[model samples]
Target chain A: MIVKDAVCPFCGCLCDDIEVEVEEGRVVAVTNACELGTTKFMGEKRMKNPILRVGDEWKDITYDEAVKYAADMLLAAERPLLYGWSGTHGEAQCVGVHMAELIHGVIDNTSSVCHGPSILAIQEVGHPGCTLGVVKNRADLVIYWGSNPIDAHPRHLSRYTRYAEGFFLENAFRDRKVIVVDVRKTESANIADEFIKIRPGGDYAVLSALRAIVQGKADTIPRTVAGVTREQLVRVANLCKSAKFGAVYFGLGLTMTQGKYKNIRNAIELVSELSRHTKFTISAMRGHYNVYGSNEVNTWMTGYPFGIDFSRGIAFYNPGETTAVDILARKECDAALIVGSDPAAHFPRKCLEHLAEIPVVQLDPYPNATTAFCNVQIPVAVTGIDAEGTAYRMDGVPIRTRRVLSSDYLSDEEVLARMYALMQEARER
Target chain B: MKVTLAMKPAAKWFIPIEAESIVPKNFLSGTDLRVWRGNRELRLDEVFSVSVEGDADRAEDVEVVLSGDTFRLKRVGEYLDAGKITVLGGIGMHCGNFMSGGTIEIHGNADGWLGREMAGGTIVCRGDAADYCASGYRGGRKGMKGGTVEVFGRAGDFLAESLAGGTVIVHGDAGDMTGAEMRGGTLVVHGDCSRPAANMKDGSCYVYGTARGMIPTFKKIGTVQHDGRTLIRFSGDLANRGKGNLFVKGYEYLD
Candidate 1:
């Protein structure tokens, strides 16, 4: 059986043009997807059974028992934290938020650790943004700052920025000017028309200088800022100013550094400043397929975006304070309910120590670092493979994820709904 | 009049409660105020135990004490012209958003957008504050145009971003972008700042401790003495031809 126009739930691109060949309820071949997507669709490292951590040993448990155990732990605790909804569908996230509210817990997503700084910056200096279609259609000057989409988002350039032909531009690659700014020459930089090598943690300085040059404040800027000369900065500013339409896509390189949100703020402000001269927009290179969806859903349900806390019987938000990393490191929660993310592997040592000490319930399709550490582990069907739901792209475009295969296991939404129901029933009792 | 609203411990608010309507100015006549609970409009009495002790017509004359955790309450004191609102626990997002006049004292930590687009007010968070405090919303250019926000504890990133006019003081360490894209404002951090001021058009940021990162757009203008303490003053966010001033305490020279 061949599945057409299936959305790949691997990365934030949400490439919906994939064709999957399924045989015996398993994906055999995937076409039009990157290597990462192929690996995800193939169910590599997929966990089969629900496991429970007992006396430092993993024991397979039935789905019903897993749900009961998860609910029990959540209800028993004074303060339970629900973290990570970026990998699941919007439906599951809605249920998860409800669960968090009922339990008076802290609910946060992966963005708290990643593009959260970008969100903060966007909230500060409003984003001059455009959809991927707009970038493909009108953008003539494309700048990739502190991000290597070649290795991360392999199909991004060919599908949207560099090679994709739009209505106004025939030969997109030839018609557009590509600029890459990073600490080192990356794979994406190798193919760019201009590559500006910046010193580590110098993104803010470089971005500010570029903004100064664009705003005609060059007199105040030093000849050499962040190792980039005045001539290079001026040339880049001129290109941005002269372009009919410009788009900048930044990644963790900007958010993870010392400046964090400041780097992104400078970049966004620069793009906003460029808009004064020409049409310019900016977007964060969101990593997960539904990470943007998690934020969108959380924003609609709660006034705040992410890092929400409901422990006080109301939804509260604070990034550094309420984020998963900080909350876990602080060891504030008595119990934790994690969904669709593996913080045990990704978080720092201090955070992992707190997570290990707590009673954790993890709901995911695969058994990873979190599964091994969690007290109760529930196996759910893989999104876009054995389950279908709504997912948002990196640019905040909602797309329907199609299921190409069947699975006996429950979906993430079903599991969360069941958990919510179980918790409600237990509370009443 | 002094109004005290305490949340019942058993009450778990799944739907966001918009408490902007429960300001002191609206309760002078002791009329039952209605707030939105999800899609339904419910009276304040249904969720909170409302009691009015004193009598007053103006918002500033009224004292409102909101006890318990109100982290789920959205827009706590939005669009307040005058009043004194005190939250015993943490507050949700948009706590004092668009407040022209008022005093919101949060005894506990605060969520993001603590004083979003606040035109005038005094917001004091005894605990830490989340991101976007005294900052603008998405697509907005002007942030806390005029106000005073003091966080006794740490503050998250993007503190006072795009601040048109305001005063923000943090006693504890601040995350990145202390005063970013600030057109006008006065931001003082007694603790360490990750990355102080970037792309600021006009503003003044004084750091009593260390500033982790510095933008090349700022030129060091030599040290100055303030309150018997040595401080290094720098000018320019030269990116936007901004005449912003950044003063760091016990500053070391950086080439």
Candidate 2:
């Protein structure tokens, strides 16, 4: 036995066409999964080992005891925040939102730091976007900006951009003019026919100059401008303008830099301007598979995309006001329930400073940086591995996450339901 | 009419909504417009008619406060000739982009890409700015044309690239490769810089920092400078024949 349709929730790709063979309630073999996915499938699954912090050290406790303590801490807190949900199921995400509402706490996703800029750009100017399938099949000009997919998304080029054969684009890399723009030279850049190195934070500036030349503007300087000259600028612009179909892909290099949000804003605006010439679009290289799904669901339900705050009982949004980073850094929150993300490793130095001060609860499969600092740690089954759910790919395509292995641990949804029940019980008491 | 954009905090996300434009009665003591969503989208000619007018006392109390919580607007077009919009606190990404007319100024540090794919506009930053201040996006090529960005503080990487037109001036140190694959544009860096400087076949960069190892692909050319500072130039990114030139001077970094 195996599931014909399985999904891999290892990264933002959320590849849904996975086949698995299970034996003895465990996955024996998996097909169409990336390296990270394979590691996830064969990894160790521990027991209910919920740990509690007494004063300094941690002690393993029963699930019931841990759950009870978690409930108590949450109930006692004045402003409790629930963050993260990328690796969890949609059902669990719904439960987490409800919990935040009942507690009048702030609820934020991983977007507070990582791809928050991309989300903001989308809200400003709607995205002219398509799925990966569209890129493989139709895109003739592929441009990677501030990202090295070879390291991050290993199979991106082989499966879609450079290797795979689509209906329309039979010749993959040969037909496509690969261009890599980044701060440092990367492996992906090595393969690109044209590797244009822009100064860090200079992407916005460089793009402006190129657009100026494309529109037929003349400017002369005795020396080079940021290492580039006038003739090459015109040629690159010509390549973009002549392409039948083009795609601009970028990653954290843009968002993580000093110009985090501005990077994505310019990227989107660039794609928008490219569309004026021919057919051009762009996609953010999202890290978590279900992040796009969460954004989609949250957007449809609420007018705002992410970093939501429910302090007034009803939904009121001010991204700067509701952003998790600001709330945590300012020490406005007292307690927190973190889901799938590992903020200890990813968040800035200032953000982690405040997170350490709160009474934190973590729901994760493994012991990550955030879990190590939490007061209560509850283990949960990894979505698409031990639990099945629906998630969205980086391109905003929803796919069914399949369950191949069985687990004794609680699902994220189950844990959330239990917490909600405990909260309701306390209110009635 | 003054347009007020505001966002409210919900449990999971922030809700952003643009308010209907309203005409203000006062031409002085500029009206305050708040953005609930970190990003506020204003159509061309929407806020060009309004101005911040006669509020010496009010200006002292709150120097153009645009709070994220309250959705308010200040109109002073009746008393002033030009409209001035000054953001008091930190703003979301693309704070000022694609403005054909009028001036939009940010007082605090702004997120990435200052004047994104700008056609016409004047944007000035009082604080540091993030990457891609006035560059083109990935893939389609063609960047800023007919606009200007002046960063008074330090700037993040990729100051400008894939540029077709525009002038960018950084008063402080800039991140790696001031301009990479730029086609056309003028960039002036008044501080230190990092590597792989520029890969463009076109455009001009004036750096005051030490020039590092030039890509084996780029050919050594000449040198030039403004205000008495010397700068070395090289034509490079032979990967594209780019005829693009890179200028660096002072600490001798040519590799």
Candidate 3:
């Protein structure tokens, strides 16, 4: 049977037009989704039961025992870390926050590594952004700065910016312009009308020069700014000004560069400057499907987007200090609960060293890199496949992911609810 | 009163202690106070061997001296409106956060966010200072609104980021994005710095040494004499308001 309108729980695009053919409780084929989303829909080798590490090997454990053990460990810990909610649904993320507040611990998400810098920049200069639908409808000029959507978010162009049918344009594909800015020529750059290659860590300098050019200070700018000629800068500035509506989408390449958040701030300020002449907007090309949801929930519930510390019984936020990477690397957390995302695959070696020392509990479907560090690993249903919940898109649009198949395994929300229930029980005592 | 806190050895050296209440005014109330190790709150005496040298009537008369592995202690003088704090060795992150008045002296190296958001008083770091020194909190519009921060040694990245109103002086080479987004302030770097006074609207940044990767927008406005040295003055970052002044003895661009 084909399940229609299932959200692909992969990239931040959160494509909801997926058609999944499931037979005998497993996904056999998928359509209307990218290669990355198709792979997640047809995932394999899911653990049947929860396992605990005894000495050097694994020991099968009941769900009740696992939940109780996780609760007891968190209750006893002085500084616990609840991390990795980006891969899960919003319901599970809600429970995670309450647990952190109750346990007096730190709660952070995958954004700390990806678009956290973008948020920092937005806080400083304020974001001037619009939804993906708005960009597809009205934007005549689309700039993919420091991002290669062709390789990462494969359907981004076909769905929204470059190839998507525009509502206002006479000829959507013919009239819309595409520009790719990066340190190197990427696959996405191949299709762009303009591909401006830059020097490594030169994004900040380049951005500053463009801002000056936009402000009519072109004469003050040097002949070349960060490998881009003054002529090219002026041309780009003119293109932005001439366009009726422009949209900019940036990725990790800009945020993780030398200046980090300052680069995004400059970009936003540039957009603000260009807005005086034409309509413009800027948005982050978020990585995970639900990472934006994590930020949304955390912000509304705790006032901060991520890297929140409840150690003082009130939510105290400081990103660099309370973030997961800094917490693990500094050996601040004695116990850790990892839900949905893998830290061992991404975290630095220093953080892995502390992960090895701490007692860790993880809730995931497959045995990923983080499984190696977990003393207790519990299997759960994957969102949009056997489980369904709300997920926020890259542009902050909420879509309720539809379930495609039946599964014996519990969902992330069910598993976390069990843990939170036990925690509440222990707290009342 | 002179309060002395000598840190005691801990089983876990990695877990830091937060003693934001260690300021002189808090001590004027009584010897009783609280500090945090992770989520666990402990008596001030639990982490340190506390002693009172004398009695005082006002906050200005009280001074706090910290010794022994104080590098792991954080927020030593937060919200310090007055008084003085002296760290014998290296100090930790947020040594004097949001301090409106008083003085903090660190003999050894200081960590990130040293003297952060200090509205008044002075902080003298005899050793090298880490990132975000004399800067604002994350997402705060203004930093170091009014105060003085002097680092006798080298400093790290984003030094005095978003500096609004204050004076910061560094004797050795400073790091990237110095005086970034500074709207009102005076910054002096005795040695070289990268991308000094970036995106600043209104302020004065002086680099006695070479300025590397000079932003392209700042317009050259001839030369001027500053403190017996003939420096090149530029009116920028023209990218923004183009009102800020940048003075550099020498400069280089990535061009």
> Model 2 over residues A125-236: C-alpha lDDT tens digits?
5688998999999888999988898887877887778777878876775787888988789999989988887666556445545655445442422133445555666678
Decreasing DockQ order of the candidates: 3, 1, 2
Stretches of candidate 3 off by over 4 Å are none
Kindly list the per-residue Cα lDDT of model 3 for residues A26-119, writing each as its tens digit: 8999999899999999999999899999999999999988988899999998889999999999999999999999889999999998999999
TM-score of 3: 0.99
Clashing pairs in 3: B119-B146, B145-B165
Considering lDDT, which of the candidate structures 1 and 3 is the better prediction for this target? 3
The lDDT for every candidate, in the order shown, is 0.84, 0.67, 0.92
lDDT of 1 by residue, A27-98 (tens): 899999999999999976667878888897888899889998988888877667789999999999999888
lDDT of 3 by residue, B179-244 (tens): 898888899999999999999988899999999988888889999999999999998687888588
In model 1, the runs with Cα more than 4 Å from the true position are: B1-195, B201-203, B206-213, B219-236, B240-243, B247-255
Model 2 per-residue lDDT tens digits across residues B1-255: 233323233342322222222212222334443222212244312332333333443211222223343222211111211244455444444544554434556677766666667776567788888776776653336767767778888887767756777888888888865675677778777887764344466877667765443333445567776578667777644434466666777533221
* Cα misplacement distance, residue B69 of candidate 1 (Å): 20
Candidate 1: C-alpha lDDT: 0.84
Fnat of model 2, as a fraction: 0.00
